[model samples]
Target: MAVRAGLPRITARVHLDLLQSEDGRRTAAELTRRLKVSPASVSVAVNYLVRHGYVRRERDPQQRRDVYVIDDEAWYRSVVLSARQTLETARAALASAEGAGPDDLVGQRMARTGAFLERISLDLLESADRWRMLLK
Candidate 1:
């Protein structure tokens, strides 16, 4: 499944999908049982998901374990994050090339790329804002 999705790990792919499902909000033990993976594997994959802002972990008041949650806007957040990352990277590249001649191919390309990413990021952010307002 992960391979077909171009994802690096099966655990990550499954974990994310699971979090979006009705059976999500599970503890590590639950994920282990559901995913049929080792506890350590689930832990590592869940950690990765948390790091990427793809999933959130919340303490379950009645239990010692934490619940893993995937927000309804998780995918929307991911898209905006990707756009922001691209824009930031492009800006960094252009900034680094600031000392170069304007006619320099590398600098020119960097500037163009930065502008393109900036536009894309802005559009995505606007769309996200609209979605939020509409969802409210």
Candidate 2:
């Protein structure tokens, strides 16, 4: 599911594994062992997930190791981030449309695309907010 949503395969696997873990957290060593992947691979995947807001990293105080966690709010954060990116794309598209001139065919298409994306982005954010309220 994560891969389909555009995550790399290894990163998706790491995410799923962490999501399924009893504690919603796993160390790199644990992920490597469980997923039968190299430690370096897990590191790269986790780093990507962390940077993308899909996962968070924390130090395991007792073990002195890094743990990757997928908290309950992970999905909300990811959706919000995605919506923001969409809005950025929309803005760029609209700017390009303006530069291309109002009557140009390409400009018209871009304007429509930009409007659609902007609407979708706003809807996603609104839905996320409603779901967050319901969940809480």
Candidate 3:
């Protein structure tokens, strides 16, 4: 339900399927079988999550299977990475706004947004570190 709330139907289903499994890991076939989803659907969803660093993939040599594991730090990594990405985006915004005329509305909006994101990025990093320290 939580997954469904945050993700599209297929991706949520895949995440839930693996999360509900016994060991927090499953082969793509296993996920497909469990969710009764098409292989391509699983592949797409798994790839998306993996690309976002939410899922960790490994290969089983003997079984020749691709196992997808739910990363314990999935949330942390996702948040931190997004924050860092926002930082980069903000930098770009600031650069683009550099030569704009003083009355440029777009430039003004960009500047404000960039400054906000910059602050948010720093706050997010600080909070993430604090959370990590608390967890330890």
Top lDDT hit: 2
Summarize candidate 3's per-residue lDDT along 1-136 as a digit string, tens digits: 7554577689888887777878889998888898998999999999988998879999999998899999877888888998999999988888766667447988888888888889999899889978975433
Q: TM-score for all predictions?
A: 0.79, 0.88, 0.83
Q: Could you give candidate 1's per-residue lDDT for residues 1-136 as a string of tens digits? A: 6557665584565566665678557777778877788888888888877777777899988877788887666777777888788778868877856756588998888778777777878888888877875523
lDDT rank order:
2, 3, 1
What candidate 3 gets wrong by more than 4 Å, as runs, is 1-6, 101-106, 133-136
Model 1 TM-score, 2 decimals: 0.79
Top candidate by TM-score: 2
RMSD of each: 2.6, 1.7, 2.5
Model 3, position 5: C-alpha lDDT score: 56
> Across residues 8-46, which tens digit of lDDT does each residue of candidate 2 receive?
999889988998999888989999999999999999999
* Candidate 1 deviant stretches above 4 angstroms: 1-6, 133-136
TM-score of 2: 0.88
Residue 90 in model 2: lDDT = 99
Give the C-alpha lDDT of model 1.
0.75
Clash totals, every prediction: 0, 0, 0
Model with the higher lDDT, candidate 1 or 3? 3
lDDT of 2 at 113: 95
Alpha-carbon shift of residue 12 in model 3 (angstroms): 1.3
